[model samples]
Target: MTIRVLLADDQALLRATFRILIDSCDDMEVVAEATGGAEAVALARVHRPDLVLMDIRMPGTDGLAATTAICADPELSGTRVLILTPSEIDAHVAQALQAGASGFLGKDVTADALLDGIRTVAAGDSLLSPLATRVLITRFLSAPAQGAPPRASEDLGALTAREREVTAWVAEGHSNEEIGERLFVSPLTVRTHVHRAMTKLGARDRAQLVVIAYQSGLAQASRPAQR
Candidate 1:
């Protein structure tokens, strides 16, 4: 199946460049392009693309708000957002995940890496590595945004023990295969647990699941592994 994409960027040159590159791929196609956040949301609703390649700093609405709206709409449940920014600032990465982006990538990535990132997010995988992901979430999401209501730890009550375990591992940025290895289960089983956790927690994707795990204190950030 072709991975339908909506390009959301303010620069026409970038959009055009991306369109040419994406359309060259047999497995994906650019279904639409939006110059700003509001148009991205509108075009997303109309096309219902499989994935949106979103830029964070567009005028009016901005990518984070647009991402929140798209993820919250039941009609757009199958659609996933992948944030593409010129700068992969820590706060932006954290906010993008909170906004329900499935993955985050810097615009400076190679053409192949960008294409692979699209496939990864479209396939419901978070793009960051386990250690990097943990550090980012632990640092940024550990504290609730100012004036934002505190999230209840009890909100995790709906998940089973195994689901919770899998979610914690996910929050640490472990892939299904790695989690399964630790649990002595197949990757498919790990995926099942992850999906169940997401369903129970109302998570938009693995990235949001990570956010929830940190916000609810199910996962704690640890020092990065010694290189």
Candidate 2:
């Protein structure tokens, strides 16, 4: 299936460059282009693209505001926002996430990396530049990530030994492929374990899985600071 996308950026030249790359992909198309944040929302409403490539800085509402509006609207249920920005600053990172952006890509990312990121976000997975992702977590997505915890740690003794192993890497932000590689299992197997682990732990998405890993003492052993 073709993945329709909307491009929003203040720079007409850069927007055109990105369009060239996106249009070159057989399964991707750029359906709308907006030069400002407000127009972005309007175009998004009209086009209903599968994904939005958002710029952090724009006149008027800005990308954070536009992302919040578009993602929050039930009418645009399948649309996910991919924040495309040059800023390594954590404030915008935190804001975009709070606004419901599913992924982020640095402006200087290679063409291949950018395409991969667009695909990842469009597939309902969250992503961030490796370094920027770390920065984001340390600076903002950390403590109080999902509001106050009910206790010092949540229970996880229910998991089988193998299930516990997978949960540790999941909290470390390992993708299915990564987990598979580490454990000498197939990605499909890793996925199965993850699914079962989440069921047993009553966890949410991967991010929350990370939170659980930490709370359950799984991540504690691997804590870089503890070593």
Candidate 3:
């Protein structure tokens, strides 16, 4: 199936460049374009594209607010947002993830990497790697929301013991392969456990799973300061 994409960037030149690259792919196509964040949210509601390629610094509304709006909309549940920015600043990454963005990509990413990210987020997985993902979780998503403490362990009651273990490993920045190797299970098994945990916790994807793992206190280890 073709992946429908909505391009949201203030620069017409960049939008055009992305459109050319996306449309050139057989499995992807640009369905719409937006010049600003508000327009992006509006077009998203109207088009309901599979993915929105969003830039953080738009003229108005901004990508973070737009992402929150889109993700919070019941009608747009099937739509996913991917933040494309010039830097992988941890603060922005954390904010975007908290706002329900499915993935983040630096603008310096190669065309192939960008296309892969679009596909990854479109397929209900996040684009963050294990290490970067860990730092994001440790530094931002793990923090208490509204100055409250992490949710009680009972909050993760829906996940099985094994699922919780897998989630903790994930929050620690282990990939499926790494987790499998550590647990003596196959990568596919690890993926299944992760997916099951995601389903039980009502997580949107792996990034959200990591967020929940930390926020719920299932993974509490801290990491060194990120550069």
Candidate 4:
């Protein structure tokens, strides 16, 4: 299946460049383009593309707010957002993920990496494997925003024991294959459990599941052991 993409960037040159690159891919197609955040939100609602290539900074609504709006809309729940930014600032990454972005990529990424990221996010997976991303999620996303009202997490009682285990593994940044190996199950089985967890938790995607796992303290972040 061809993955439909909506490009949202403030720079016309960058958008055109991305359009050319994405259109060259056989499995992906650019369905729409938005120059600002509000326009991105509106286009996403209208096109309901499989993914939106969102820029972090934009005029007016901005990428973070646009991501929130798109993700919050039940009609556009199936659409995923992949944040594209020039910098890998921890605070911005946390906010982007919180706003429902499935992945974050630097503008300096190679064409192949960018395409792979689009495909990865479109396939219901998150591209947060980089160490910086891990640290950002661990340190920032786990804590409640300052001065923000305390919020209650969704009940995890709806998930079975195995599903909870799978979610924790996911939050810890384990891929399906890695989780399957740990659990002595097939990758497909692990994926099934992940999907079940997401459904029960009402998560938009695997990224949201990870966010919830960390925010709810069901999983704790620790530094990766030295290789």
Candidate 5:
């Protein structure tokens, strides 16, 4: 399936550059472009693209607020947001995740990495840059209340034991394949558990699931390994 993408960036040059790159790909295409957050949301509502390649900093509304608006809209539930920013600060990464972005990538990433990130997020997997992952683990997930309100443990009571286990691994930044390898299950089985957990907990995506895992005390954040 072709991945329909909406490019949201204030820079016209960046938008055009991305448009060219995305349109060149066989499995993906640029469906629309927006210069700021409000326009991004409007275009998103109109186009209902599979993914929005969002920039965090913009003139109005901003990408974080736009992400929140897009993710919160039930009509746009199938749409995913992938935050692309020049600054991958801790707070920005945390806020992007909280706002329901399925992925975060630094602007400096290679074209291949950006394309891969888009595909990864469109395929229903969360993609975080290495720095973003570290920030998520060491800052936000470690102190979930700082990023968002904490969920009571009973909120997690709806999840099965395996689902809870899978969620914890997800919080620790394990992909479905990695979680499956660790748990002696197939990746598809792991995805099933993830979907079940999301349905039970009312999570928007894996990123939100990670937030809930920490907030509900199903997962404890720890320092990421040094590369």
Candidate 6:
């Protein structure tokens, strides 16, 4: 299926350039465009695109604000926001995750990496452009985690034993195909299990869903989520 997308940037030229690259991809389409954070949020609600490309700094609300707003709403749960930034500072990267932004990419990324990041985020996975990832790791490691984590899936009490297994794999960064291989199920089945988990947890997308798994103590790196 073609992934529908919204591109939000303050620069009109920048937006148009990215729009061309997005529309050129056979499996992706630019469904809407926004010049500011507020416009991005408003357009996102109206178009309900699968992914949003948000700029970190802008007039009106700002990409961070728009991402927070969209990610917080239950109605806009399926939409993913990927932040575009010049650099990754600790404060911004940490804040973005708390606000529910799914991924980040540097503006200087090659066309291929940019495409890959979009597809990754659309597929319920997170991506940090290499530069962004390096900065985040350094900062995240240095910064002291300030608050308690988000409530876990167990608190939701909507997942069955089997569904919890799927969510655990998700937290470990396993894709549907990878999870299916480990579980001895078809990828389609993996998707079903993940879907069930999402419904149970009331999660909007995989990034936050994984966060829930990690924070809730449902998912760990040492072991896959087991039924």
Ranking by lDDT: 3, 1, 4, 5, 6, 2
lDDT of 4 by residue, 1-227 (tens): 99999999999999999999999999999999999999999999889999999998898889999998998898997899999987765587787887788988988999999999999999988878746446777788778766653234447778887888888778777889988888889999999999999998878788888788877767663322322
Residue 1, candidate 1: C-alpha displacement in angstroms: 1.8
lDDT against true structure, model 4: 0.84
For every model in order, what is the number of clashing pairs? 0, 0, 0, 0, 0, 0
Model 1, TM vs. native: 0.88
Off by over 4 Å in 2: 145-168, 181-184, 193-227
- Which residue pairs in candidate 1 have backbone atoms (N, alpha carbon, C) closer than 3 angstroms, thus clashing? none
Write model 5 residue lDDT over 1-227, tens digit each, in one string. Answer: 99999999999998998898899999999999999999999999999999999999998789989998998899999999999877666576677787688978888878899899999899987886545554555576556545456788899888877787788777777777888888889999999999999989988778788877777777753323322
lDDT tens per residue, model 1, 39-113:
999999999999999998888889988988998888999999988876654687677787678888888888999
Itemize residue pairs with steric clashes in candidate 2. Answer: none
Best by TM-score: 3
Query: Least lDDT summed over 10 consecutive residues: which range in candidate 5?
Result: 218-227
lDDT value for candidate 1? 0.85
TM-score of 4: 0.88
Give the TM-score of each candidate: 0.88, 0.75, 0.92, 0.88, 0.87, 0.69
Q: Report the poorest 10 consecutive residues by lDDT, candidate 6.
A: 136-145
Backbone clash tally for model 2?
0
Which stretches of candidate 6 lie above 4 Å from their native place? 1-4, 11-13, 25-32, 42-50, 73-79, 86-91, 116-149, 225-227
What shift in Å separates residue 17 of candidate 5 from its native position after superposition?
A: 1.3
